[model samples]
Target chain A: MLITFGAIAIFFAVIIVVLQLSGIKDRDFTDYAVGGRSFGARYQAMSFLNTWYPGAMFTAFGGMAASAGVISFYVLSYSLLTVVLMYLMAKPVWIWGKTFNLRTQPDLLALRFGSRHIRTIAAVVGIISGVPWLVLGMQALGTLFQHMSLGTLSFAEAVMLGVAVIALRQVWTVRMGMRGVVISDMAQGIVAYIIGSAVLIGLIVWMVLARGISFDALDQKMFAIPSVGSAEGPLYLFSLILTGAIGGWCWPYIFVRLFTADGVESLKKSAALAVPLSLIFGVALLIFGMLGSQVPGVSAHPNDVWFIVSKEAGGLWLLGLAGVIVLAASMGHTDGNIQATGAQIANDLVGNYWQLGERQLIVIAKLGMLALTILSSWLACLELPALFSLAVLAYQGIIQLAVPQFLGIFWKRGNKYGAIAGMVVGFVVAVVLELGYPGYLPWAYGLTSGAVALVVNLTIYVAMAYLIPQSQAERRRVEELFDLIEGKRSAAAVSKGVREPA
Target chain B: MSDDGKTNPNNHAAWIIGWFILDAVVALAPPIYWAFDRNRTAILGLPAVVTYFVAVAVFITASIVAAYLAEARSGKAG
Candidate 1:
């Protein structure tokens, strides 16, 4: 118990010290929201990893692999596709963000559609979908604390401890803003992913060689994946992969990472860099979970497989390290979500209504962060069994933003009415279907509610694009935005002697 | 388009679309994954299905790196 608690305490102390030395003071709202758009490839990559894989990667996701078999590989598939999307979208997103001083995903939407109403609607959807994940992050911390206590603390006591620690971390998050969140993500991400991968590899080696555990010895059911003929139906895995790949960037927190990069090249490099890291870490972690399922006590409590296996393999010290890794991951995820949500609330929701200065916006954003932390912590303490289900539903709802986001950036004909209509209608359909059908839709041939809604959403968006024409001024503005991107690329090519001036 | 001075805004669209289609086929296609879905074989001490997915991940990573290099070579990485 002492070893585990001490390790976590030392980890927190080092992170706080690193953050303080990194200079958390922001010169203005841009610096506060995006670190003045000055980060390089590595920081952007780590920040994405930190936000993308929450501490639940160890608990819930690992648990899924332990209990559910090869279906969990969907995460790996979608993660690779997500990075591909990042690389593809980096140019327009970064260029527009820098040009318009856009600070949130909704801010980009507003800029693309030229409507405050679109901004408000997107912001509301982003916040509503975002809050559940924040709660889940807090609950993940609760699990980490419970295991770290080593029977010294009850679950309820651990819940409070977890909530309190995360709440305390928000003090710095509120003060230093996105810059602080990104820097700490660097430190925390190294601990959680780099060192965490080493630990996973070590555990796998020990389990395989020492314990003589191999695929042949385990239950054959563990190897089965959902297929065309299976009860899960053909499209189950496809739907999951599609949603994760597209919906990933729709998250305000993850989308905002694009703006933190210094240039499109930095984001491109970050996308490339993230692919291998995600593959290695994700594969190793899930492999460990699968192998650890055979360990005593793991089958009954699969969510604790990470902690149980670490303790069995390497004793107290390894368990301590495991706890620290999960804590690091959870802290980074929670901090980023809080910062991004706060920025959206301040810059998109509130600032859209009233004329506010940069200083006032920063103040409002900090207050928003505080409110979100308190709300998520309180929800975490409730220990609701339905919270995880709500988080899954949030994924369904969040994906509704994808159509508008993709079309708005890639195609200029998508008017504000179409964007708003598609998002509102798609979000409603997702929520209704998710609540009615739960995980998968039988009538839709195993497609998820989100995927079904997306089809309808895209149809409406495309139809509206043709049905409603933009005003001449709106058309010119949209044309100029596209021209800005092309003009910049052509100038860069000419300067590099790759092409002649037009 | 670049040679013609039109400067196609989505010069990399072919790369993105091509890889995306390939990935979907590799990951979700019934013909490919179904071949290894069974646990009759263990490669590298892992179930064949698991090993196949890991290989798929590696393939995707390598593809992204290839695309990045190609973009850089074309001077469109910015």
Candidate 2:
């Protein structure tokens, strides 16, 4: 217990020291919001993977794989597809961001559509969707706290410890802002994915060689995909992948990273680099969960498989390392979430209404982060529904941004009214269906409520775009913006002074 | 086509369309696992479905890297 707790304490201390010593000087809202659009391939890639793959990837997704067999491979599909989406979206978004000095995702919407109302709507909707996940993330840390405690602390005490760690992590986040978040994400991502991969690999080797449980002995169905005729069915998986691929980048934290890259080409390189790392980390966790299913006590509570396996393999010390891995990942994501959500509130929502100076905006953003931490911590203490379920519900709302954000880039006919209306109607449909049907919608016969809502949302977006025409000025402005994006994308690489790889 | 009607390899439309095709292939291909997911088949000591997923991952990675390189090349040329 001492070894575990001591290691965690050291880990926390190291992160703080590194963050303080990094020399992140935020001169204005630009630097505070996006690191001045200067991150290279490594920082952007690692920071993105860090924020994208939260600790829940290990706990919830891993647990799902262990309990549900091959059905869990949906994550693998969605993850890879999301990267492809990233590669496609990154270049255009980067150009626009540079051209307009855009910071938040809502800022992009407002710029693209030429409407502050769209920005306000995007901000409000983004915060509403994001708050639930923030609350859920704090609760997830409760699980990490319990595991690290090794039965020494009561559940309530563990929850408190979890909240305290998150609040403590926010200190650097508040000071450093986006620059701090991305740099720390790179550092913490290394600890979480690279070190975590090594530990899982060791655990797997032990499971196979020492325990004598071969893949052949595992459940036959574990290797099989669920059919459309099965209880869970094809649409369930399809909806998840659709939501994941499209909505994955729509998350305010993830989308804003597009602006942080140094150049358009750097964005592409980041996507290429992020793929294998995300794949290795994702597959390793899935394999860990699958192998853990063979262990005795772990199969019963799949969520605790990583901890149980660690303890069995190398005692409390290993379990302590495992707990640190999960904490690193969870904090990496939670901090980015707080920073992005807070930035959106201050820069887009509040700044639009009131003209605040750079220092005032920074102060407001810090206060927002502080307020969010307290609220999320308070909610984490309360009895709430499952963390994973709440997260998926948030994704349903986030994905609604796809049509207006993604398609609006390619198609200039979309107006602010359509963008705002699509998001509002999509969110309402997702909420109504989620509340009425919970997870899967019987009304759609095995299709996820999210998928059904998305269909309605897209239909509304397309219809509104055609029916509600953009004004002549708005149309002309959009065309000029699109031409600029295209021009920048194809312009000579000499401007960046970096030769393209042959 | 350009105003001269010559084929343009560096055309943004071609790249975008090609990317979309690749995206559709990857995003829609996973459902094919349903047809060959049975555990009776094993490949290189791993389940056949697992092997299939590995193949798809490799394919997606190669395609994206190729696209990225091509874009980089085109951007540099202009």
Candidate 3:
């Protein structure tokens, strides 16, 4: 069964590789990496879903839900709510991307702040911020492979399998950049959704008729998974949800994606579709969790839920399909995010101080992705409590941008000094709280840091906008950026399901 | 805050509708729970909490109703 599954998976993988590589148009690195910053709704939606929602979260979330009960929905909802936040921020980000021709976050900071110092801080922070996520993704990938192997492979062998595939996949990523990444993502999204939906419907029907189960029965069974042993209050839901949605828009990888869309409306339309797609995919995991609740037949870990479901319910060929789809999902995620962070480091930090060529920039970006992929693969071996924890930790720090960036974009008085201060302060506070207290209970609520970031960012922005005076050039740049965004929007366009950032 | 925090000052009603939807999503927890509990299997004397469970039911009548109202309110007075 395992051999048959692996064969089917390899076959589907080859097809995906051909589809992704067939039309690679990345003549240069920026085009390869950022796709020259022009993504319509379809591409945006495809890439966003594929790239945004991967890692151990997908593999482990179902198990966590099985353990945590109703609270599990919070994790899933937190993931989905980010799209709504993305919808709000996409307008400013796209407008800025178009105006400044910015490809990386550091580029945006440098363009506006005109300070290499600020860009360096932001770039380094981007790399540092992204490390845990990369490692977590690698870990989840390794875990999934091992658990799926069912003792056929050793632990080290499992990790190596994940690493080998990632190493192979980077060959294309190093060449094509975001264009290749998106094409690959679109492929993954299409294939995964089809397979995922088919599996879900099949499971739903099988469980109802064959297994004789319902959602309520499933919920009741799964509810006792996360035992709250006097930790945070149930209100933790409120904080986590608030932080997840609000802080979510600020994530560097996902944030960079907003800038890659074709236009404001395209971005928004993609967002409208993207949110529900994320939710549906999420529901598939939840259902799988419900199936696993109190039932034990396989020796798989949290990350192997998809594989387990496929292997148990269907034939060997379907198991192979599940493996390839999961791997594709992982690759699509790492490609854009790793490369984007690399570009940020090279351009924002190195080039900000000294001019770097497209060739040099591309080389550094490739190296960066290579290093990040390897590092993440290695990190996958460690005992990280759960995928959900790492995901939240990642957002807990970055979400501080809820005030400084997401809200700051529209606010006129939003000055660089205030935003910088708020972000710095909020970033520090969040990390400390998360480290010192850490959130497992309902009370700590994910939003404590989010709220702090919002408050500080707003307070600082308002005060700075009022007290500080921008030089003529800076004010003009701000006005130009805003004006371009305002003049371009049309009411009729929105009615046609064209989502605008505004 | 200019009655609606119109930072960019292009439209009014859309902003309200957006923020309203956002706030409602955050504030309304009990109703969400109620719908899940009732339709999936009504327990005891309590009616469904959400008053509208789009997730349950065969035809998705609840989702349509909710979506229609949201659309109507968000629409401009042409």
Candidate maximizing TM-score: 1
Q: After superposition, which runs of candidate 2 have C-alpha atoms over 4 Å from their true positions?
A: A386-390, A443-445, A488-502, B1-20, B29-31, B73-78
Pairs with backbone N, CA or C atoms under 3 Å apart (clashes), candidate 2: none
- How do all the candidates rank in terms of DockQ, highest first? 1, 2, 3
The Cα error of candidate 2 at residue B39, in Å, is 3.7
lDDT of 2 by residue, A14-92 (tens): 8888888998889999898898888988898889888988888778888887887666777877788888777767656
Superposed by TM-score, candidate 1 places the C-alpha of residue A428 at a distance from the truth, in angstroms, of 1.0
Per-residue lDDT over A19-131 for candidate 1, one digit per residue giving the tens place of the 0 to 100 score: 89987778999999988898988999999999899999999889988888777888988888888888878888887777667888988888788787888888898898888
By lDDT: ranked, best first: 1, 2, 3
The CA lDDT of each predicted structure is 0.85, 0.78, 0.59
Q: Give the better candidate number (1 or 3) by DockQ.
A: 1
Residue A319 lDDT, candidate 2, scale 0-100:
85
Interface root mean square deviation per prediction: 5.5, 7.1, 9.5
For every prediction, compared with the true complex, DockQ reads 0.36, 0.26, 0.12
lDDT of 3 by residue, A217-239 (tens): 54443332122232454334556
